[model samples]
Target: MRLGLVLSEAGSGLRRNFSMVVSIVLVTFVSLTFVGVAALMQLQIGQMKGFWYDKAQVAVYLCNDAVQNSNCPSAATTDEIAAVKTALSSAPVKTFVKSFRFEDHQLAYTNFKKQFKGNPVADYVTPDILNEAFWVNLNDPNQSAVISEAISGMPGVDAVTDQRRLLDQIFAVLNTASITAATIAALMLVAAALLISTTIRLSAFSRRREIGIMRLVGASNRFIQTPFILEGVLASLIGSVLAAAATIGIVQFFIQGYLQTAQRDINFVTISEAIVVVPILIGAGVVLAAVSANVAISRYLRV
Candidate 1:
């Protein structure tokens, strides 16, 4: 009987402040959607790092006739190439290197042609113009800096390039995007909380006479507050469900339908990741609404 009365009062409050309830729902929906997106972005970044870092290699490029710089004053001689080969097999650096393959001029030119197959620049390139390189795969990708420092400034080495450096730039951009989304979500959530509080205050004010009557009848504060809190919780619950649906749509249409097909090489966040985020969003919304409503009602009742 008490539960039914509490539920009935809660429904009455919601209907009385219909516009405010709708506002809370919309605000929470947008805020939780941003939260879900931010989470998925971080997940996508982690997946990319795990996939790319494992395959990244350190490439030590040798001096060629076409390259004339302080690092490569002249084309690398056979003796210089042999010196580089000996250093690779030696200690300190050798232990970190899992395996190394030397690509000669002809092989390098062949790869260049294939990479830039239809490009006009491929026509101007030849075997003699390309630098021979040693592609070293390290046991730990983080040890790339150690290998780079060891091989750099050698007689035949023009440059030591770690593929992870390029990957870092990509990851940096993704991190920035994630931070931006999280920031927006936080601001929206604050707005939603304030809206919920305002809605609760209005509902309490409208029923001040009824509250007084209940107080005279020896009703407890818990009984008076339950209905208002339920009102906030119900509104937030609706918003959370809408946000979950939107999140699923993004994963299905934007991520899987478009990104997976468009960028076949990259792995995107799937529906499973969205499913994981849904519960989190719903919990956050419910908790925020409940707390905001409780605080607002407590303050109103005290006065």
Candidate 2:
């Protein structure tokens, strides 16, 4: 009987302030949408870090015939190549270096051209003119500096380049983006909370006389307060649910459909992953509403 009365009062309150309920729903929707986007952005950053970090490699370029040096002999000598290979295979760094090898200029140019098929640079670059480079796969990409330091002055080696540093810079940018999104979401959520509180206060204000009469009769504090609190909670929760649905729809229709098409390699988390955030959002909204309603009723209850 208590539950039914509370529910009926909640329904009556929402029905009377229907416009305010709509506004609350819109605000909650907007806030939770940002929260969902922020969650997906963080997920993407993690995915990118894993994908790029695992595939990172160090490229070691060798001297060519045009370069005049005894170690290179204007070109990589048989003994020079052999010595470099032997050093790589049996050096102190061997355990860390998964494998290292030489690639002819022609093969290097072929792969490079394939990547830039119609570009102007592709027109000028050919395998015969390019310098040969040795590609090194490491057991750990983060140890690029150590690997480079070991091979820098070795015979037949002209330069040691580690691509991992470039990836680190990119990862830093992703981290910054994630932080910025989180900050924005935090501010918006606060704004939503305030709006919800104000809306609930106004709704409570309209029923003040009815509440006074209830107290004048024989109503207990809990009996009067429970219904109002439940109304606020219901409004907030319904708003959050609407927001979650809209967020999922927008992501599925726009991000996965368009942005992903343009950048095929990037796989953003799906709506299912983003949906995990809904329960928290709804809970927060409900709690905020209930607390706000309780505070507004406290003054009337005391008087």
Against the true structure, whose TM-score is highest? 1
What are the per-residue Cα lDDT tens digits for candidate 1 across 20-42? 99999999999999998999899
Model 2: lDDT of residue 252: 82
User: Per-residue lDDT tens digits of candidate 2, residues 1-303?
Assistant: 388878989899989999988877777777776776677778777877788777788887777876656655666667877776776787587888887777888788888887798899889765666668778888988788877887788877877888878888988888888788778877877777677667666776799888779879989888988877777678778877886776677678877778778878767667777677767767767776777778766655676
Model 1 residue 211 CA deviation in Å: 1.9
Go through the candidates in order and give each one's C-alpha lDDT: 0.93, 0.76
Model 1 regions lying over 4 Å from their true place: 113-129
Question: In candidate 1, residue 8 scores what lDDT?
Answer: 97
Candidate 2 off by > 4 Å: 63-81, 128-131, 155-158, 254-267, 295-303
User: Clash number for model 1?
Assistant: 0
Report model 2's TM-score to 2 decimal places. Answer: 0.84
| Candidate no. 1 TM-score | 0.92
